[model samples]
Target: MTTIEVKCRFEAKLLRPAKPGNDKSWAFVVLPRDASEQLPRRGRTTVEGTLNGHPFQATLEPDGQLSHWLQVSRELLEAAGSVVGDIVTLELTPVKKEPEPDIPADFKEALAAAPEAHKVWNNTTTLARLDWIHWITSAKQLKTRAKRIDDACDMLASGKKKVCCFDPSGYYSKAFRAPEAENS
Candidate 1:
């Protein structure tokens, strides 16, 4: 029942933004390095928190070579009536439930169409499924995402239970580390 509360500014820096004439960009609120260490895990932790009085559940993810961050979707900002650079108050408690990835509709349909793959998917653990979903959704392009769905169905049907050569941890894959966490 350890509840971690923090009051901090909303960091609005764009994360891995697309180049000129590119797709949409991502943004997040950087968790203070000290506060990040208080969490149970690095990435994909379910958090119950309030931002500017708006309660929400957020997936705390690692920033590349930096501290953990809460993805500040436009919806969230609007709901909280917050904008970039606004100071925010957060009261967070890590929930015990396993996180479920936001599976794209196309991917779900693809799996449903492939019974064998769907069976495999159903039998996989939540974290394993999350990895597959992450790998697919991580694709920056529409075509690439579609390709991943096709590849995933084929691979799963062939009895592959996990994503090939995929690292679920942000460490080796993305080298995400906070200055304080670097030594931890």
Candidate 2:
């Protein structure tokens, strides 16, 4: 496997700002071509060394951004007397992408049913409906994929237009159980 290692300084803005002490951590973005050899799931590979004398765990996002959730205490930040402007070094070792999940047929039917709106949505690339399609279709299981579709339909039918807030978890609970396989 080919691994790309990058050294970059985190600007602190990438961290979850809502969480306290998040500014002390750093985020490393990675794009792994293979689907099964990524970090975190396999085991801890020490992606981040000591940062301001504190330890941290590197978390991988679905978008391929590796985030180091620093274990630094608030007292440590106060003692070091540093704020968001402080630079933190990050070393990212590329892994592999997870396998793309399969989308259910019902979900595809739901998308197909909105042919006119789907056409309109496809016309507007700025709205990210295509990205939503990609995300929804990536589910590996039939039930999961159908749930994603139902959630997406509910959101689109409501005239919200944006698919980012559509939660498949809720739909999965109510629908999408024991669904038949979808033809790609």
Candidate 3:
């Protein structure tokens, strides 16, 4: 079989804005609109790329706008010898197959208890599973989270293939967003 190479390249500032100078010292780079447009989809996109000459893979999250952003971990920064406020070079290509996401322990047990829901989940696409996980984990309150898990099981058992009323891009609901820049 032949392979098709569809790639996009751009330069962006590597910003270390999330919980700086600690165990959670995180960084990220945003893809400009023109470059983001070349991507396969506007929703959360997974890609394998090189960051400042170091190879890496990440899921690029939509910024609620037309663009996308990446969350670069501290370990990634150190591996590439990159720092915040530096112009980082990147090349990305969309992954044809998404990797499986880890299921939360509570959700795992919930699924196991509900055979129909578990079967539906097992048959759903990886991306849909990711959205379900995202919807479940995005809840900020404990009670809300438990309710979501219960609702997810019910929905799945009812033959709902995807999470209902979830805005993965977070554009309208403002539920999903990149880490705010320290200077912003």
Candidate 4:
């Protein structure tokens, strides 16, 4: 196994608030040692490092949770090294792994008929799928629910994974129209 070591200094300004949904204690940002290829590609690599003093490991995701943010342990860093502010430097190295296979076409075909929507949906991450399923299943009317499925499929085929009702510019588009508001 190939391993590289780096020395990092930690600063207080480099720390970010905990994620809204998790009990993470600290977060930091670190540039990948190798930038020739994006991190998280199949068989690409795993990054392991110590921030301040806390040890952490991170894997690359095609649609990464921490696209630009890196989570770390504040207490760990303070315990391992002296953190004066928000900046910290540490040694990091990448471990390679095999890539995952592409999604199956049959799975994609199971989506709604809107080709555009299907395309977008197929490209979205699993978390997006869970969110969409929850949203669609919560609808009260069968017709409304069907319409949501159609809209979702169309959006996916159109190369959009989210924001079904709006264009890339964030304007309302005729492509996706939600059901009219019910009379109060």
Count of backbone clashes, every candidate in sequence: 2, 7, 0, 36
- lDDT score of model 2? 0.42
- lDDT per residue (tens digit) for residues 1-184 in model 4: 4444433333333444433236444544434434313344321134665665567675422212222234455666567664324456555445443223333343344564455566566677654564455345545687866766666666566676654332311112222221221222
lDDT of 4: 0.45
Deviation in angstroms for 11 in model 3?
A: 0.6
Candidate whose lDDT is highest: 3
Residue 32 miss distance in model 2 (angstroms): 9.4
- Candidate 2 local lDDT, residue 143: 86
| C-alpha positional error of residue 89 in candidate 3 after TM-score superposition, expressed in Å | 0.4
For each candidate, give its TM-score against the true structure: 0.67, 0.31, 0.90, 0.35
78-162, model 2: which lDDT tens digit per residue?
Answer: 5445444455433344333322333356665776897655554444443255446555765779788778777777666655566
TM-score of 3: 0.90
Q: Which ten residues in a row have the lowest lDDT in candidate 2?
A: 175-184
Model 3 error, position 176 (Å): 1.3
Candidate 2 Cα deviation (angstroms), residue 26: 32
RMSD of each: 6.5, 16.4, 2.4, 12.1
Score each candidate by Cα lDDT: 0.68, 0.42, 0.86, 0.45
